[model samples]
Each structure stands twice: as C-alpha cells, then as structure tokens.
Target chain A: MAEVKLTNVVKRYGSVEVVHGIDLEIAHNEFVVLVGPSGCGKSTTLRMIAGLEEISDGEIKIGETVVNNLPPRKRNISMVFQNYALYPHMTVSENLGFSLKIAGKSGAEISAAVANAAEILGLGDLLERTPAELSGGQRQRVAMGRAIVRHPDVFLFDEPLSNLDAKLRTQMRVEIKKLHQKIKTTIVYVTHDQVEAMTLADRIVIMKDGHIVQVGTPLDVFERPVDTFVAAFIGSPPMNLINGHIEADHVVFSDGNRLPVPPDFTGKLADGRQVVFGFRADVLMPKGHTLAESGVVTDLDLKIDFAEPLGSESILLSTLGGKEIQARMHNPRPVNEGEVLTCELHLEKCHIFDASSTKNLRE
Target chain B: MSKFSRAIRDHAVPLALIAPSILVILVVVLLPLMFSFYTSFTNYRLIRPDTLWDWIGLRNYQRLLADWDFWVAFGRTILFLTVALNLELLFGLGLALLVNKITWGQRTLRTIMMFPMMFSPILVGFQFKYVFNDTIGLVNNALQSLGLTEFAIPFLVDRWLAFFSISFAEIWMSTSIFAILILAGLFAMPKDPIEAARVDGCSNWQVFRHITLPFLMPFIFIAMTIRSLDVARAYDVVDVMTGGGPAQRTELLWTLIARTAYDDARMGRANAMAYASILLSIFFTWYFFRKLMDARKHLGAF
Candidate 1:
C-alpha cells in the first residue's frame, strides 16, 4: 500500500481546461471517493492518477516517486471501469490472471492468485465462463477480481457500480467495501452517487465545475459542508436552502417571515447580510422526535404540499417561510396534503451560507 | 377444380409475387449453367456450330486430366491466389493500423486510400501496364535516371517479374476493401478492452497482439470471404498486363478459361475448366466462412 498524492493537478483538452489545479492526498490504505456531477472532472482526476490521462500541470506521487510520466502499466495501478471492461474472449480466470501473466509470473503463481481472488469474490463457479456468459453483477466481480490479483499500489474505480440494477449496485457497493477492508490498499474511487461516497469513503472529495469544493470524512462533510454546493450535493432528498437576510438577531425572509438566529450563530452574523438558511430533512422532524442530534430547537408551522411515508420515516414536502422545503417525520402517522403540521428544527444542526459567495457562513 | 389447382389458387397472391423472380433466375442463371454443363461433356466449339450435337462423352475431361499445360496453369493460379491474398491482407492490416492512429486528416487519407479500389480493374491494369512498360515505363525511366541499370527491367516480360507485376496490380486495387472493413472494425472496437489490457501491464505491442488483433480477426475473415469471391475479377487486370503470356507465368484460372473459350474457340474445354475453377471459388468461400465463424466464436460473439 502507498499514499497517492496529487498537488495542483490540472487537466485540459485543447483550449478548454476541464480540471483546474486541484490538490489531494489519499493516505495509505485509505478509501477516498471523488464525487461530483457529470463534467465535474472527478473521473478525469482519477484517470490522471491512474496514468490513463496526462496531467496538464501537477505532480502525482504514488508512494515516493512522481508518476506523471509513467505509463498506466508502469504506474502499478489497476482500474475497474464503469462497464467492467473484462476481456470478452477470455474466461474469468484468465481475466483475473491477465496482469500476472503479462508480468511473466509462473503459471502456478498466477493460478494461486486467481484462485484467491475468485474465492474472495465468490467467482469459483465462474472461472470457466467468458465475460459474455456472465451477468452484469458477475462481470463487475470479475473486474474487481482482476484488479485485486495485480496487488497494485492503488485501485481506481470509475463509477463501477453505475451499470448495475439498484439491488445489485447496493450489493456490489457492500462487496467493494468488504474488498477494501480485506485488501487494505489505497483506493481512489470516483462516482456521482453521494450515498456510495458516504457509505464507502474514509475521505470524500466533493467537486463541482472542475474545482475541489470540499474534502472531508463522510460525517465531517455531512455535519459541516464547507459550502452550499456540498450541502445540497451530499444528501438525499437534498438539503433545503431558504433565501433570507440577517437583521437584528433574526433571519428575515423576502416574504417578511422572520425567525430568530439559532443560538450557535448568535453573534456570527452582521445586520442586513444576505445569507441562505440551510437545514437537512431529517433534522426537522415532527415535534418531540429527534434522531441523534440533541440541540436548541425551533418550532414552525408548515403547510404540507405532499407526504411520502417510508414506514419508519416520512418525507413531508412543505413551505417554510414561503420557500419549498422537505422535512422528515419519525414514526409519524400519514398526514394529508395541505395539512398544517408543526415540525422541530435542530437549530445547531442547520447550515448557513453567504448568499453572494455561497460559502458556509459558519465554516 | 382439382386439389392441386385449388391449393395454387389459394396461394395465388404469393405465387404471383414470386413467379417473376423464379422466371428471371431460370432465364438468366439456370439455363446458362445447364448449357455450360452440357457443353463440358460434348465436343462443342464456337466456330463449328455442328459440334453442338456431337456427343463425345468425357473426352474433354479425359484430355484435361493429362494436359501438362492445364495442370501448370491450375497450379500457377492457386499460387497466385495464395500469394496475392496474403500480401493484400498484410498490407491492408498495416494500412488500417496506420490510418487508425492519425487523428488529423484521417478522413482525407481514408478517402485517398480508397482511390485505387474505386478505379476499374481494367483501368488499373492499363495504368500499371504503362507504368511497367519495358522501355518507356515510369519504373524503367526512374531506374535509368538513378543509374541503377543500363537496360530497362522486363517487369511484364520476365516470368517472375510479370507474376509480381500482376499480383501488385490486384493487391493495389482491392487492398482497401480490407482496409475499409478493418477500419470499420477498428471504429467499432470498444476502448475499454484496450484500456483494460494496458492496465493489465501489457506493452503496446502486447495489447495490440492480445486484444486489438483478436478483436479484428472476425472483420479480417469477413474481408477475406468477400475478396476471395471477387479476386477472380482481377482477370481483367492480369489479362491486360500479361495476357497469360511469357510461358503462362501469370496465368490465373479465369485468364486461362477466357483464353480457352474466346481465343482458341474451344468452348467445351473452357466450360470444363470453368467448372473446375468454380470448385476453387467454392472451396475458398467455404474456408473463409468457416474461419469467420471460428473467429466470431473465439471472440464469444456466438
């Protein structure tokens, strides 16, 4: 295992610069996920680290040596592509042992490695099957097996689970997490799915528009997103942002609705400063019910536009201070649309962003 | 009113739809094939119409069996097919690999590469005939100007040189058929396998040999199957360039058949030779098709 470090890495296609100078450091045996929307340069950054793409400017070190000029093979890294990228003509065992074969290892050593990977991936029965004969989930496992057999310094996965169905994707995601635990190698995985990053990454790197927006542990980023983009991007049902301004110890909405500032940020804001009030759905549950967070709470009445009951929890779509918002209800009875419900907001759990720059105000 | 007539009447629309095609086939294909097969057993000559009724059973086949010249031509034709097809494949593969690398002006280069394939084989034959002319040809002039030799090289006269010259023209005209098809194969090739091979620690050549070449085999066999049937069409070029002369050095099957049928007016012998050459075509087509299927199976496409 080796530490993968990128200092000011940049990627440009002709006159168009797609990946701006970005710095990242993935420690030895750490699982770092690069998550972003399409065209956000997460995949490009991963490819550059893999040496499949050239860095326009920067230094990438896979241990003690800079690998900017190294070819992908010489870089001693393995990649699992979104399509699984298995050799269609070869059987699963051959695909798993291809790197070892290329490295000129003895047949016995290659087979041993193949057998180990197959056993780990539950691919013993699939050794003789070609890629075309395998299902999508099986092919994904073979791809992972192929990567592991090489024992490269780092593993790069580019949306490897995106092609599978939801159940299979979830299963493979858990399998990948288990694989990482077993192998204990540095991994730089790129995906647009925040849930994958949240569940699997030791450190999650969130990017947008070619820039690294934030890099933190999943809980760190979830608890304290550095900016509005990270806040909205890293959660499902998304964080709600209400446009408002700080005025006299209270946030004033454009439609004249006002709420006192949470006690945590009592003195952090100046009067008349425009800001975005952000809160997560789970925090604003029905009164008297809170998840893990216990803090100073505020109560507000919201007219429900719709309610989605998910058995243990329900997502209530409503208007807060004249802006669309989603609140979570814990073990609550189903409520009718347009019903007025009082929900509690864990004041300390909410986020506030500067309106002009969109950075977290309390960061 | 009968059962058969009633059945036919019941399928009248479908029968009517197919009748024209069947009639056309009988008139244009089946009749000529039957007439040719019949002539192969008779002493039919184009000049002597009365020989049409003469039944000389197996006489032409018996004479051809012992004819040393016929055997030599047959052997030469096989040699020509093998050498020309292999050379074309090599050059075509090289050209495709080179063209696939060019990012700029690739469209223009591909269009230019197809220029030879666009020219008629007869036109290409005439073109090369002048280019290889013993004295005034471009090749001889260039050699003379460079002081390589005092006498012009007999490119179309010496037995081996004439064989080389004719095969050159054939390869030049049809190599792009392989290139175009192989390029399409290259275009359709997924980038993931090549990338996977590279990540698997393969060098450039290894990646090409193990991944790219295997991926291209099915396309190569497809091109071979098509060109095998059409390689006979090179008769026009060979006829114009060497005319099966200089001791029959470049005598392909079709050239020999054309000479026997038209030049010697021995239609019966030519038809017999034509029937024998048809077997060669069928064999090549069958061989290439089997190879195509094998390649597809190896790629797990089947």
Candidate 2:
C-alpha cells in the first residue's frame, strides 16, 4: 500500500482545460472518494492516478515516486470500471489469474492466489463459468476478484456500483466497505452518488465543473458546508435557502414576517443587508410545548402543497410567502393540502449565508 | 363462400405484385437447373441437339470414372482451391491488420487496394500472362538485364511454375475480398473487451491472442468459405493465361468442364462434372455457417 498525492494537477484537451489545478493527499489505506455530478472531472482525476490518462501539468506521486510518466501496468494500480469489464472469453479463475500470469507467476502460485480471492469473494463455485454466463452482480464480483488477486498498491473504482439496481447497489456498497476494511488498501473511488460518497468515503471531495469545491469528512461537509454548492449537494431532501433581509437585528422575509437571528450573526450583518437563511428540513419541528418551547423558536405559517409519507417521517412540501420549502416532521400528523400549518424553526441550528457570495456566514 | 372469397381477395394484390419475380425465377433459374439435370442423364450434345432424347443410363458417369484427364483436372482444382484460399486468407488477414493500424490515408489506401478487385478476372489474367511470358516479357527482360538468369524462365510452360502462376493470378484478383470483409469484422469488434483485457494486466500480444483472435474467427472462416467457392470455379484466368495448354498442366475443373461443354459440345458430360463440383461448394458453405453460429453463440449473441 502507498499514499497517493497530486500537486496542482491539470488536465487539458487541446487548450481547453478540463481538470483545473487540483491538489489532494490520500494517505496509505485511506478510502478517499471523489464525488460530483457528471462532467465534473472526477473520473479524469481517478484515471490520472491510475495512469490511464496523462496529466497535462503538475506531478502525481505514488508513495515517494513521481508516476506522471508511468503507464498503468507499471503503476501497480488496479481499476474496476463501472461496466465491470471482465474478459468475456475467460472463466472466472482465468480472469482472476490473468494479471499474475502476465507478471510471470507460476501456475501453482496463480491458482493459489485465485483460490484465496475466490474464497474471500464467495466465488469458488463460479470459477469455471465464463463472464457471459454470469449475472451483473457476479461479474462485478469477478472484476473485484481480479483486482484482489493482483494485490496492487492501490484500488481504483470508477463508479463501480452505478450499473447495479438500487438494492444491489446498496448491498454491494456495504460489501465494498467491508472488503476495504478487510484489505485496508489505499482506495480512490469516484462516483456521482452522494449517499455512496457519504457511506463509503473516509474523506469526501466534492467537485463541480472540474474544480474541487470542498474536501472534508462526510459529516464535516454535511454540517459545515463551506459554500452554497456544498451545502446544497451534501444532503438529500436538501437544505432549504430562504431569501430574507436583516432588519432590527432580525431576519425579515420578503412577505414581511420577522425571525430572530442566531447570536453569532448579529455583528457580521449590516442593517438592511440581504441574506439567505439556510436550514435542513430535519432540524425543524412542529410547534409544541417540548424542546420547541425551550429553544429559540422562529415561527412560520406555511401552506402545505404536498406531503410524502416515508414511513418513519413525512416530508412536507409547503410554501411560505410564495417560496417553496420542504420540512421533515417526525410525528404522524394528518395535514391537508392548502391548509395553513404553523412550524417552528430551531434558530440555533439555522445557518446564514451572505446573499451575494453564498458563503456561510459562520465560517 | 363469401368469407373465403374475401380472404382470397385480400391476398390477390400482394400475390399479383410478386408474380413477375416468381415467373422470372422459374423461367431463368429453375428451368436451366432442370434442363442441366436432365442433360446429366442423357447423351446430349450442343451440335447434335437431337441426341438430347437419348437415355445414356450413366454412360457419362462411367466414362468420367475411367477418364484420367477428368480426374486430374478434378484433383488439380481441389489443390488450387485449397492453396489459393489459404494463401488469400493469410494475405487478406495481414492486409486487414495493417490497414486497421493505419489512421491516416486509410481511405485512399483502401480505394487503391480495391482497384485490382474492380478489374475483370480476364483482365487480371492477361496482365499477369504478359508479365510472366517466357520471352519478350517484362519479367524475362528485367531478369536478363539484371544478369540474374541466362535463359528466359518458362513461367507458363512448366508444371509447378504454371500451377503457381495461375494460383497467384487467382489470389491477386480475390484477396481484397477477404481483406475488406475481415476489416469490417475488425472494425465492428467491441473495444470494451480489449480494454478489459489490458486492465486485467494482459500484455499486448496476450490480449490479441486470447481476445481479438477468437472474436475474429468467424470472419476468417467466412472469408475462407467464400474464397473456396470462388476459387473452385477458377476458369477465366486459366483460360486467358495458359488456355489450359502446354500439356494441360494448369487445367482446373471448371476450365476442363467449359472445354467439354462449349468447345467440344459435350454438354451432358459437363453437366455431370458440374453436379459433382457443387458438392465442394455445399460442403464449404455448410461448414463455415456452422462454425459461424458456434462463434456467435460463444460471443453470447445467440
């Protein structure tokens, strides 16, 4: 295993730069996931590290050696593509042992390594079947097994679970996490799925338009997103931003309703300056005489547009003064469409962003 | 009665549209095939058309069995087919591999390679005939001028050289057919499996041997089967170059059959020989098709 580092790496295709200068450090045995939307250059970055793509500028270091000029075969890195590119003609055993055989290992050694990988992946019974006969999930396992048999210095996954069904994706996600735990190899995974990034990454690098927006642990990016994009991207049932202005030391909405600002925002804001108040749906609750009564509460009278019952909690899609907002409520409350509902926003948990820059005010 | 009439009424227009094609096939293809089969059983001659009424009762078959000239032509045809088809396949596959590597000027080179294929087989035969002439030819003159040979080489007169000369002309005229077809196969191959093999840590040669070659097998056999059928009926080049002369050293089955049917006016015996050669074509086509299906099944497309 080895730590991989990229120092101001840039990728350009004929004068148009696709991957702007990126700097990252991945320690040995760390599971770092580059997560973003499509065309975000996450895959390019992973391919550069795997030596599949050339770095147009800057240097990439694997362990202590610069690998910018090294080919993929000499990089000691194994990649599992999203399509699970198993050789269609070879049986699972041959597929697993291909790298070892190419490296000039003896037949006995190759078979021993293949057998060990098969046992770990529960692929012993499938060793004789070609990839054409295997299902998608089994093919994925064979692809992983091929990588495992090599015992390469690094494992790279480029959206490896993107092709599976949702339930299988979740199952494989857990399996991959468990496998990483067992092997503890340095892994650089790329995906557009935020949930996978949250669950699988030791540290998540959020990117947009080929630039790294933020790099932090999942919860760090979740609870303390540095900018609006990270704040909106990191969570499902995403954080809501409401347009408002500071008036009389309180945030006043466009509809002229006023709410108390958190104590930390008082000195940072100028009077009559526009701001966006950010809050996650789960942090808000129905007005009641419990914690809502004790904590600093900002009231909102919202008209319900729709409600999605998610078994454990219901997501309420409602409008406050013509602005759409989604709130998660825990109680099994019966609410009708177009009915006015009074909810409490926990002021202490609310985040404030400057209207122009969209950066978190607390940061 | 009314329902039956209505069903017939619905089918009448479509069947009417196909009537000309059916009539053409029956008049053109089926009539000739039936006439030839009938002639195979009779003692028919082109000059004496009245002899078509005679029932030969396997006289032509008996004669062919004992005829050393006919059997020699038959054996020579088989040998020519085998050698020419195999050589064409080798050269064609080499050409396809080379053309596949060329990224620039590929279209121009492809057009230039097809120039030979566009020429008539008779033209190619005449071109090579003059080039390999024993005297007053380009090859003999060049060799004499270079002082490589003191005597004019008997390219069209000697047995082995004559055979190779005819086969070479045949291969030159048809090898591009194999190359074009195999190149199409190469272009249509999926890039995913090759990339997968590379990521599996396979060297370039290993990837080609294990992945690329197996996928191209059906195409190779397809080209072989087509060229076999084509080369077995080799006549135009042989007729022009040597005229199956110089002691009939380069005579193939079709040349001998044409000589009998048209030149000697023995249509009945020629038809019998043709029916025999049809077996060779059938065997090759059937074998290649079966192998093609197996390859498709292996590729998981079946």
User: For this target, which candidate reaches the highest TM-score against the unseen true structure?
Assistant: 1
Docking quality tier of model 2? acceptable
Native RMSD of candidate 2 (Å): 3.6
lDDT for each residue of candidate 1 in B65-98, tens digit (9 for 90 to 100): 8978878887887787888789888999999999
What TM-score, over all chains together, does every model reach? Answer: 0.97, 0.89
Alpha-carbon error at B302 in model 2, in Å?
A: 9.8
How does residue A178 of candidate 2 score in lDDT? Answer: 94
- Candidate 1 lDDT, tens digit per residue, A131-231? 88889999999999999998999999999999999999999999999999999999999999999999999999999999999999999999899988998
Tens digits of per-residue lDDT for model 2, A81-115: 98887776677899899889888999999999999
Tens-place lDDT per residue, model 2, B1-302, is 99998998999999889999999999999999999999999999999999999888798888888889888988898899889988988898899999999999999988887887999999999999998998877888999999999999999999999998998899888889888988888998887667666666666788888888888888888887777778878889999999987888988888889999999999999999888778877887898888887776657731
Off by over 4 Å in 1: A288-293, B1-3, B298-302
iRMSD (Å) of candidate 1? 2.0
What does DockQ give for each predicted structure?
0.64, 0.44
Candidate 2: misplaced stretches above 4 Å? A244-249, A271-275, A289-297, A320-322, B1-26, B62-67, B101-109, B134-154
